[model samples]
Target: MHHADLFGPVDAGLPEGLVYRPDFVTAAEEAALIDHVAALPFAPFQFHGFEGNRRTVSFGMEYKFDGSGLKQAEPFPGWLLPVRDHAAALAELKPEDFVHALIIEYAPGAGIGWHRDRPVFGDVVGVSLGAEAPLRFRLKEGSKWRRFTLPAEPRSAYLLRGPARTEWEHSLAPVSALRYSITLRTLRAA
Candidate 1:
């Protein structure tokens, strides 16, 4: 699959001052990755709905890093390898104890509620997989919402930092098929 650099820096539409890269993951990898994740145990990737409400839903796998943050022991295999390689590829970026978590969401009839990611984990990075889901960000004190339609292709990576990192609230829309995503974040030590 061909990777598309859909948007550049100036026009990166993020309410929280984040950047969007559509080509972060490829389509071929998306299929394989989903298959792999599906085979995994329900515990690591199960969707947990709180209360009796039908809307509240969340799914993800958390991985704790070693002293160097380079190696981690999570039941999900091959998950740590990519993070290690990514850390090596980027300059000025090192392995921190707070690495990241892989989250796959399923918003079948309706999408997620608007909310800002927890700051306790530091910067959040994500890759879109599965179906094409639109993400909208609400600007602070502004009526307009900056919306992004993320491709459900696999192997792509998106980085959120700076203004998009702190200010905006993000959520997805409903889709016919399952909605899947992989997010990476460094968890702060308690």
Candidate 2:
């Protein structure tokens, strides 16, 4: 079942502004993207000098590992415009509004840890490619945690906004197969 819309009790029982669109890209598009992604030079994700297994290539703006803020990296590439349009539409924003883009390659046994996007970013739009994995989200309420997991399948796109973007922390538990994800983010208005 495709959970494609503004959030309120989705198939995964998530809350608030957690939109998803399965089949966001055609099979041909997915294949083309995977080929392009495989060619890009990626660096291991670093946080405080500790490197993560998954590698990434950032465009438009890159995050400063020191947590100071984002800095300009390579300019956004034109080849990704088609995919960005789908992601932006899911978030109800223009593609040009997104100022940061990331292409991540998750090798076997690789997955991202739990964390929310930086406050400097507004909405989080991500397109999953190449494999299936559980995209988990959690929130601390009182003394307990409320959690939900969405099956992030190939060709699917999801958006995190409002409470989902600010209040919940999401992560991709380690996966068995290779995978790729394209993330697009809009800068928070000054």
C-alpha RMSD of each candidate structure in angstroms:
8.4, 5.1
Cα lDDT over the full model 2 = 0.87
lDDT of 2 by residue, 75-97 (tens): 87778887778787788789899
Q: What ranges in model 1 sit over 4 Å off?
A: 1-16, 43-76, 83-92, 95-98, 142-156, 188-190
RMSD of 2: 5.1
lDDT of 2 at 83: 78
lDDT per residue, candidate 1, 52-154, as tens digits? 1112112233422222323333542574455434532431255443355555556466466777666566566766666667665554445544444444344
- Report the error of model 2 at residue 178, Å: 0.6
Model 2 misplaced stretches (Cα beyond 4 Å): 1-12
Question: How many clashes in each candidate?
Answer: 13, 0
- Prediction 1 global C-alpha lDDT: 0.52
Tell me the TM-score of model 1. Answer: 0.63
> What is the lDDT of every predicted structure here?
0.52, 0.87
